[model samples]
Structures are given as C-alpha cells and as structure tokens.
Target: MQLSLSDKFHSEMARLCPAPLPSVLAIMVSGGSDSLALMMLAHDWAAEMRQDPDNGPVTLIAITVDHGLRPESAAEAEGVAKIAHDLGVDHVTLQWKWDGVGNLQAAARAARYSLVQEWRRRKRPEIGAILVGHTRDDQAETFLMRLSRGSGVEGLSAMKALPLSHKAADAAGAAPVIRPILWASRADLRAALQARGMGWVDDPSNDNEDYLRVRTRKAMRDLAKIGLDVDTLTRTADHMARASVALWARAADVARDVVTEPYPGILRFDLTRLERIEEETQLRLLAHGVGCLTQAPYRPRLSSLEALAEAAYAGRGATLQGVQSFVQDDALILVRELRAVADYECPADGASAWDGRWRIKGRRLGEAVIRPLGAQSLAALELPKGLPKTAFQSYPALWAGQALVAVPYLAREGLCAPQYDPSAEFHRSILSH
Candidate 1:
C-alpha cells in the first residue's frame, strides 16, 4: 500500500531534528492508532536517514506504558511489543503499579514519566530526546480542558512540540521531549495507518463516560451541531499556544528577577518588588515561579495565588498545597516544609544526623549538653525516664555509650528535651559549626 502522508511526515521529521540523530530514540507507542502510526513514521524516517549520505542511522525503541486499569492491559502490551518486533524496533513495556492513592490519572502520568526518565538515565543517558505522539486533536482537547477549568494563557496553550523543562533542578534531569506529529490530525494519522494496512488496539477507557476527556470529546462532537469543526478548534489552539509561549517568556523574566534560592528547596522573593509589577503579570510570575519550585505543571488555584500575593504584600504568612510563604524581616520565605515545632528524642554522644546541609552531632554530657532548640523544648529541667512517643517520632534517636545527647538540627525539639545551660561543653560540641 502506498503511504504518502507517512512518507511526508518522515521527511518533516528529518528536517526538524537535523543531524546527530540520538543514539537511542524512544517512541511512546501505546498501541493506539495515533501512537502506532507515529512509530511507523519514525521507523521509516530512521531507515531513510540511514540510507542517506548526510544523516546517519538511528536506533528506535518503542515504549508501551500499561496503566493496568483493564484486565486486558497486559495482553495489549504484549501485542504492542509483538508489533514493534515485527517492525524490527526494540520494545519495552512499563507496567503501572497503582497504589490506589491519589488521582489515578495524575499518578499514572507521573509514574509513566518517572519510568521513562529512569530508563533513559540507566540505559541511554546520552540520548537526546524522547518522542510522544500527541496530535492536533489532543492539543485541542487539552486547550478545551484548560479553558473549562478557568486556565490562563499557559494552561490553554497546552502541550508543546518540545519537552518541558523541569521546574526545579531537584526534579528529573533536563531532557527535551520531542513531539513529531503535533501538527498532524487524528483523522490524518488514522488514514495513514489504514493506508499502510497497520492495525492498532482500541482502548475502551477512551470511550468510557467516566473520564473527563471522554465527556469533553462527546461535548466536542455535539459542538459540530453548531457548525464548529475540529479543524477550527485545532487552529485556535495553535494560536493560543503561540500566545502562551510569549506570555510565559515574559513571566519567566519577571520570576528570575524576584525569585531567589537562598537554601535548598527554599525560595525567597522580594514582596516590595513584586508589588510594583502589574497585577496580571504578578499573578503569572508567581504561578510560574511556584510551579518551577514544585516541578509541577498544574498551576495552583487562583484563590491560592491571590492569598499568597496578599500575604506577601501585608507581610503575613500563608500556606497552600504543602508550600508555605511567610514574611521574615525584609524578605519573603517560600518554605516547602513548614510544620509546627515538635519534640524529639536525642541521640547519644559521638553520633550525627544529617539535616539538609547541616550535620548535627549528638553527645551525652554528665552535667552539660549542646543542642539546637527551636520552638518545642521540654518545659521541665530534668530529662524524662523514657522519651515520649511524640518526641521519638519527631527525631531519629542516636545512642552513644548508653547516653543520649544531641539530635539533628531538624529535630530541634527533641535535641532540647533535656536542656542544659548554654555554657555546657556538650551543648557547644553539638552546636559547633
């Protein structure tokens, strides 16, 4: 069968990626029509480039992620692997182990990326990029979803052809995700597959009414009643995506100026400077900055951002989504872990505990002990016979010669449980720089 569109797509891929084709390129093939079509296109591109004198050959690896929501998911994965083998492409199946905790979709997404990133790190650390097969229809769906959720320009812009960078450096390393078929439509991809006589597995969940995508897709079909076409939606999404890029670039510039990293996992911002920026810009900058710190793409609620901005302006404290911001002296501290001080059991002498950058020493002293104390300290003078469960839970205890003295700086409460005078030698040892 003649595949004109597939051949054209393969040519486009060559023009986009250029030379030095990565040693190993991963194709996220879910055995669906779109992804399967993408795999075939990529395979053809690799073969053509290998034959060309200008571009060298590249290896293609097909990755199928099994969400395991259905009983046939494992079998589906096997089928995908078989197809990959038939196409002479390496295949790997990443099985999802859902713990049944948080949002199933969100968790599954995270898990999928984690597995792909880990595999790249271990096997092909030098690989330049991973390819995903998100079409124009997918982009339109994303744009509509964000619009329905009251998203800003960035949200509405949806997925990019390039891989999104990690918000924070602590997150997975920087590897660009390349989407080769972003410009292609679902119908076009389906036609390409049909033209090539390629078959794909149909995912039942895609049609299930319970999913937000399914519902939105149904609504989109209904939109056709009003003479709205999928092509129009796709074009609008494309325009919005460009606008989002410009807006995000501006926001990033503002964020770079106001946000500072004084400590690990801690962000500090100048409220006075923030207040001078325009209201919309301020909101966008704050959202972008916080999202960067959290390495999460989903922006916090508008209400949360407003409250945070208000707190920064008023020199108050505000907590949202496990992140806390408080005004301290002249600067605003954005703390990731901001919990009330609690008691902890101290470890014995000649031991240590690591708390971020600090290494705390624990040493028992007959008459004097050195330790860091924050808010939670023993009200009495003498040490209790046994440590309270609360105190023990707060700090990991260390023992030295049958005596407990210091705890990690993070366990400030427990370290000060049996308080000694500041002049004590043991106290000096634990607190010494």
Candidate 2:
C-alpha cells in the first residue's frame, strides 16, 4: 500500500527520533529537491506530533549552507529561507568560501557539517539531531565509489541513519545526526515537491561530468541494464553494514582480552595473544588502537595497516597514521608519534584537548598553556616507569610561558593529572559505529 507523505515521514521520524523528542531539531536544507522535500516532510511530521496533547512543541529549524560555489547560491539560500518561514520554522544560513586548500567538493562537505556542528554548539545546544537528506541514491553512488577503490567491509557498508558518522569531525556536545530520508528515492522526493507546487534549485555542478559523482550517476543506468540497479547496490550495502556491526562487536570483545592502557593515550597489547587472533580481528584491533590514538575518524589505509601488522609480528617497530607501534618486552606498544604532536598546543583552559585524545587539568599559572612534554620539559624532571622516554615526549604538559607547571602523566607529585584516555574511546567507538 502506498503511504501518505505524512505517514511515511512519521514512521521514519519515530524510528530515527525516539520518544520524548528533542526540543530542537536541525534540518539541513540545501535548496535541492531532496532537501526541500525533507524540510516539508519534517514540518508535516512535527505538526502531526503537535496535534497530540501529550506532546510538547518541537522547534524545527531549517539550515542552509551556502557553499558559494555557484553564482546562484545566495539566491537559492534565500529561497529556502522563504520556504522555511512559510512552514513556520526558524531558518539560518551558514556561509563558506573555498580557501583553495583541497578538493572543492570534499572540502565543501566537511566544512558544511563542521559549520553546522559549531552552530549547534554555540547557538543551539539543545538541538537533539541534525537531519540530512541522503537518499537511497546517495547510498548506491557511495557503494559504487568505494567498490572502485576496493574498499572492504566497513567502507562498503555505507551510511547508517543513526550515530553521527565517524568520518565526521568529533563534536563534544553536538546533536546526533539522522539521515531519515535514506530510504526515500530522489525521484520520489522531487515528486513530493511537485505535488506541493514547490520548486527547487538545481545546482549546475550536479550535471558537471568533471566530478566523480556525476560520472557515477550517469553510469547507474548502464549498470541497471545488466541487473546491477540501485536496489541491488543498496541491498549489498545493507548486508555489508550488518556484517560490519558483527565484526566490530567481535573486535571489541577481542580487544578486551588483548589490549590494555598503561597510560592514558598509550595502548599496549599482549604480543603473544595478538599474534593468535584471526587476521580480520587483528586488523580491526590495530585500526581501533591507531584510530583512538590519532583521533582520526577514518581508518588508516589498508596497505599501511597491513604493513604495520606484518612488522609488529616480526618484532619490529614502525610508525603509521600518527601512531608509533613497536614490539617490546612481550607487548606491542602503540603510542602517539613524538614528531606528530611536536608543535601541537592549546591554551591550558582545562577544556582544550591535547592531541585530540588527552585533557590535562591543573593549577592556572600566568598565561598557562598545554603542550607536549617535550625533551626540554622532561630534561630536569624525574620520569615515570612503564613507558619509554620518546613516548613521553608526546604526552601533555602545562606551561606558563617559559616556566613548566606540570606534566600530567609524568612527575605528578603536585602537578596536574590525566583527565582523559583513548583506550576508553577505543572501546566505546566500536559499539557506536
């Protein structure tokens, strides 16, 4: 049976945003048909919920990111804003300009999400979820792209509606994001907009064959002639996602037996036990350790991870993905490379994270700052056991200008103490993804 838009949307919302709904929800509107339909459907769903006396008024905010890539972007953003206002939802627009740093499309995507996260943090901390308009089409396209790259289980698994993507930058208090429309097809979305007598801006870049996505989109029809349709790709992605979850759970369990944290940021593994694990589990565990240390959302390259694992098995030491792994004393030690964090610094405001892993907190000296416990800082101090001196160089220390105040992990008589640990994150990340 064909369900009404209200029915379909309400069902998706119930699945994505469970009861006692968030007070504020952010809907990403890019002025495209998919996003426009998402905004309209969200409004209808919110209205349906509000009709029940038991429900409180939910704030629906439409946010448009003006990437400034097209000349029509500003006008399109305003058009979205007008529509949002008509739906009785508050609207805000985020602005971005290419600094010519990297790939324009990739950079634009990362910047868009980062901007929205920052906005939620500073402007609306109450926002419970940021909703995006990724559809079945996006999932299929991403699957093909990853397939071309020879991506394995995790990468091929594609996107999930819940739990903000790990590829996304980590935000402390930001709302969890939901792609509630992933089950919706782009054609269906445009149909909904057409039924409403509404229009959407079509960015010319979508037709530009210079981009890989456009090329992929064009190839979909040819592949479909051979029975490799969107449904086939999406189903394959779903299967991979299911397999991925099981694999992650297995890795988490194995990690408990083989991994330990002698210090906050450092990961130590039982070399003998690690060598006995299945190849898949070994790679998953090593990836988790390196990911936690580097705080990188994406896993290290497959070749690099495999090479490092081979080296560790032979009792050799090498660095990859900002983590230095060496076999020592019957253990495989993974610590942050000293060179990776040499110039890393943040104000000692007690809130700044050092190396994106540890938080160091203590007394506030004049103009205090948090930086690595380099050789110069460790020169006069008595060191601690359980870790090499080179490893300590990347550990955090508090300094007031030139005077050293404390080393959080080392020489902590009256100095500051370690406030965070990456191994905890390693264990937690497996479940969330």
Candidate 1 residue 194 C-alpha distance from true site, Å = 1.3
Q: How far out, in Å, is residue 331 in model 1?
A: 4.6
Whole-model lDDT, model 1: 0.64
lDDT of 2 by residue, 305-387 (tens): 89988898898999998888878887888988889988888876667777766666666464678877787777787776665
C-alpha displacement of 57 in model 1, angstroms? 1.7
**lDDT tens string, model 1, 179-273?**
88887888888988888888888888789888888888889888868865567777777787788667656656676667665423345677777
Candidate 2's TM-score: 0.93
Measured by lDDT, the strongest candidate is 2
Clashing pairs in 2: none
Off by over 4 Å in 2: 163-171, 364-367, 421-424
